[model samples]
Target: MGTMVISGTVVLVVLGFGNHTWWLVAVAVLFLYMQYGRSGRVGRGASTSSPGGSGGGASGMTPGSYRAYRDRRDKQARWERRYRREHPMEARRQARERKS
Candidate 1:
């Protein structure tokens, strides 16, 4: 689903470039970003889980566990950003590895 959205966005961008209608590309990108946010694949602050799962509360995570999860996520993101900045080639290689 994500790949399809990305490919569609790329096609829209190409079409917009060819036709001089930049708004088409902008709208496609905006729609993709909104969908990404709604999908919960990149969340912040709290961890989401099934309601009936262990350690889950009404909001899907117990307060303490949620805090821990958020902390870990933040730490990892920070490290990733730093790594990417410091070792761009290595970061790209690792990303390719993970994708495969």
Candidate 2:
């Protein structure tokens, strides 16, 4: 894919020079930047998952990460409890349906 993009840019720049079309050259430069710039690097590097196959990046299972995850989970639980308190009939109906 990168090779094809580079080849296309080269062709575009050559055509731009041959035709004296500055916009073509500018477009070629833009394509090159899109193919090789920081955004492109990020897209390429995003798949570097840990060996654990969690697909959550390298620090996913660290102690600090676990603590953070636990804290987030607790906060979500508290929010859910508050929501249930605010909507007791909905919660009770859902719970009753689950029992059935």
Q: Model 1: runs farther than 4 Å from truth?
A: 22-26, 29-33, 36-47, 54-57, 61-100
lDDT of each: 0.69, 0.66
Which residue pairs in candidate 1 collide?
none
**lDDT (Cα, tens digit) per residue for candidate 1, span 19-68:** 86765666867676765555555434445564348763346564445555
Q: Write the per-residue lDDT of candidate 2 for residues 1-100, one digit (tens) a residue.
A: 6566567677777777668685577685765677566344533434434344564644554433455477679999999999899999999999999999
Question: How many clashing pairs per prediction, in order?
Answer: 0, 0
TM-score of each: 0.34, 0.37
* Candidate 2, run of 10 with poorest lDDT: 42-51
